[model samples]
Target: MQLKQELIQQIQSIIATAKERAIRSVDTERVLMYWQIGQVIQEEEQQGKERAGYGEFLIKSLSETLQPQFGSGFSVRQLEMCRQFYRTFPNTNALRSQFSWTHYRTLIRIENQDKREFYIAEAAKNNWTARQLERQVNSQLFERLLLSNDVKEVLAVARDEKQPSDAKEIIKDPMVLEFLGLKREAAYYEKDLEAAIITHLQEFLLEIGNGFSFVARQKRIHIEGDEFSIDLVFYNRLLQCFVLFEIKTTKLTHQDIGQLQMYVNYYDRFEKQEFENPTIGILLCADKNDAVVKITLPENNKTIIASKYQLYLPTEQQLIDEVKKEIEKLDHDKMNE
Candidate 1:
């Protein structure tokens, strides 16, 4: 019986290893093929004999021939992608083996080279699947990073050589909770939003960005013979600190900030290990008064953060405008300094 169990376990391990290798081999081959296709397209374009229309004609002809012998992978659109795949990544040696064709297809859509490179490096380092990569790109991760950090820091982190060391680097403002399916106009309580977050914890964490891991929901803390229940608690591996979150369905007020500060103090005093950094608190509210938040928290405060939350995704124009406004504000502040 023991011998049979050992044999079965060995067979399973071998099969798993074989499957992993097969997938990697196929991915590498596909990437190389795209690189070669791109090289051919570039060479053809450089040849003055082909002219503009000739290149299109050549691709169409190639697709027509290959589609019959090959499979749907040889469709005209996919062939064009192969050409672009090469054009976008001119250096064949620079092509990362960590990414697949789908990853490249999503990346090529990004017009900004710097932004594209950032996404590529991040996706590779995080081992993001194609769908996750698409989400990050669509969510304007690069723009958000630019808003939160200096240009050099953003570039360094995006390139995966270094990570942001401050709380500001990982914290996002007006977190998009579209997955919650809550209507913007609907009147909801704080508990309602907390319930939705708990129900869709995995999706919420992904939308919350990197380094966050679920710790507890409705985490109970006792202080001075009184008990307090925090809405959600998380520990950021990157920051090496405990994160306490308080949910508010209405606009954040001084009371909201005060309550969260108390929570942060409690965690810092009682729960956090001496080796860990001070506990951080986040007030996830539906709305906020910027002036009030600024006055309520101390200047250069790092322990507590108050950010707005949106039940739905904002329009692309809105995101662009917001980023532009933030950049303008930074410029104004820098000029004053």
Candidate 2:
């Protein structure tokens, strides 16, 4: 009976694996077929003597002809997308097999080549589904990273051509917490915000950037009969350090900075192993004044970071403003030096 059960389990595993492989094979072939159709359409369009609106006419006619034969996938919009896909990825070798048509559709919408490539590399490395990839794109992960570092170097790290040596590479300044289901206008306590983060811990981790795993919540520590409870604790494998987070529902102040710094010192002194890097502390706040943060921390400080959390996504103008502020802060720091 035991031998029979084992045989059945092994056969089931084999069937499941084979089915997954077959689906992947079909998807890959379908992607290639679309690419080929796109190529033919582009070639014929280029050869046409009539230049004005000829391409549009061609796509429309082709969509009408193919829709009857190939069904809804050959709609005008899809055909146009396929054409744009070929234009964006001129070389067939550059197309990644792991990406489905939906993934490419999202990728092609990105106007910046470097940003597009970065997302592709990151999505592939992280094994993000189409929906996940779309979310990352909408959140403007590339733009947020560029807020604190050189674009060229950041792109290099995204491509895995270089490794991150500091926490800045793994952290975003203003994290979007739209998934937390919180209202911006609603008054909430620090503990409430912390609870939301804990409830949506997976999304929070993803928003915090990669390589982080949740450790503890309201972690208790004692010093000289005084008790302190840290809001959240995480371990970052890439940085090989314990990442501590303090939740602040209101605007950040010097006291908040000092508290986070103290927590960081405690971790480094007692919790962190000598082989690991120093613990990094983050104050996740609703608002922060950059000047106050700069004045509070030591001139050479790298341990504590204060980042704002937003309940909703920022508009394009808001993103631009954020970037400008970041650049100005960097300039101000340079001048102070």
Candidate 3:
């Protein structure tokens, strides 16, 4: 019976693997097909430059001919998308095979070259599904990262041109937790939020940034007959450090920062391996004032951060305003320095 069970398991594994490969193969071929079609359309349009509306006319005519034969995949909108995809990613060598047509579909819509490139590198590195990539794009992940880091550093980290030495390089402030299915108006306890995080750990990890793995919940520590329980703990392989979280369901105060800092100090002093990077602390708060946090932490502080958690995803206008505010703050900090 045991031998038969093992054989069944091995066969199941082989079937699943084969199915996955087959899907990948089909997706890759479809992407190549679309790219080639787009290339032909672009070349033909250029060849008929004598006509003013030739490009638009050409796409419509091609779609009319192909859609009836090939189904809606060759419809006017899809064909236009194909042309745009080819235009956005001109180099055939640059197309990543892991991406599906959906991934390229979302990517081609992005107008900014840097933002598009950043998402491309990050999506490829992280193996984000089309939905995951779309969520990050909608959440304004790139713009949020720019709140603390400059454009050059952000791009470099995304490209893996430089390792992330700072937590801010990857962590986003005002993290979107709409995935938790929590209501915005309702009051939530620290435990409630903590439970939600654990329940949706995968999405939480994606929102938090790269290279994080769950470690412990209500992580307890002892010091000279005293006891304390940290809210959550995570290990970041990229940063080579333990990240401790202290949840606050209200506006942040200095005490919150102090408490998180203590946990960070405890981790660094007692839990951290000698070769590992310093343990970092994050105060996940309902709200935060930037000035208060700056005054609470030491000038040279790198380990402690105060990040606001939003129950709902912000509108595009809200994200834009947030970015503008942070840029102004950066300018203010520079002048004070």
Candidate 4:
């Protein structure tokens, strides 16, 4: 009976693999077909003798004729999208077979070529689904990273031209936790927030970015007869170190920073292996004062980071304003120097 069950399980796995491949093959063909259609439309527009208003009329007429026989997928909007797909990715070789039409549509909408390219590379590397790609784009993940790092180097890492050597490359500030279903105005205990995070561990992991796996919660530690509990602990395989997190329900303070530093020291001295990198400490709080953080940490400090957590997603304008403020501060400091 055991042998029969093993044989049946193997057959089921084989069938599942074949089915997935078949779906992927069909999706790739559809993507290619759309690109081809866009190419033809672009060529026709270029060849037309009268350029003014000709493109609109061509798309309308084509859509009317095609929609009748080929269905609504050939609507003017879709044709325009196809044309944009080709325009955004002019070289056919640049298109990946793994990406579906949904992915291309999302990519083509990004106006900045560099940011678009970064998203494409990240999506492919992370194997992000269409919805996941959309979420990251909407969240302005690229802009957030640019706040602290060089754009050229970040893009190079995204494109696989360079590698990230530290945890800072993967961590994002003000991580959005709207998916946790926590009320923004509601006052909750750190334990409650920790519970929510564990309940939505999958979503939390996704929000935390790649290479992180949850290790423990309320992890107890004893040092010199003093006991302490860590809010959360994670291991980042890419950085090859333990990641320690502490949750604060209010604005970060010097004491909070010091306490986290102590935990980090404990891990570095006792928990971490000699081969492992130094443990990275993150303080997730409701608010963060950059000036406070700068003043509290040593000038050479790199292991500890304090980031804000938001219960809701900020509006697009809010993100833009924040970026502008950051840039202006940098410029002001340079002028003062």
Point out the worst 10-residue segment of candidate 2 by lDDT: 1-10
lDDT of each candidate versus the true structure = 0.83, 0.89, 0.92, 0.89
TM-score of 2: 0.95
Clashing pairs in 1: none
Winner of 1 and 2 under lDDT: 2
Who wins the TM-score comparison? Answer: 3
Considering summed lDDT, which 10 consecutive residues are worst modelled in model 1?
Answer: 41-50
Poorest stretch of ten by lDDT in candidate 3? 1-10
Per residue, candidate 1 scores C-alpha lDDT tens digits across 16-44 of 99999999999989889877977886687
Off by over 4 Å in 3: 1-3
Candidate 1 matches the true fold with a TM-score of 0.90
What tens digits encode model 4's per-residue C-alpha lDDT throughout 9-69? 9999999999999999999999999999999999999898377888888999999999999
* Runs with alpha carbons beyond 4 Å of true place in candidate 1: 1-3, 183-185, 328-337
Higher-lDDT candidate of 1 and 4: 4
Tens digit of per-residue lDDT, candidate 3, span 1-337: 2568888999999999999999999999999999988888888988998999999999999889988888988988998888888898888999999999999998999999999999999999999999999999988899889878888999999889999999999999888899999999999999999999999999999999999999999989998999999999999999999999999999999988988888888888999999999999999999989999999899999999899999887898998898889878888989988
Number of colliding residue pairs in each model: 0, 0, 0, 0
User: Using Cα atoms with residue i matched to residue i, what is each candidate's TM-score against the true structure?
Assistant: 0.90, 0.95, 0.96, 0.94
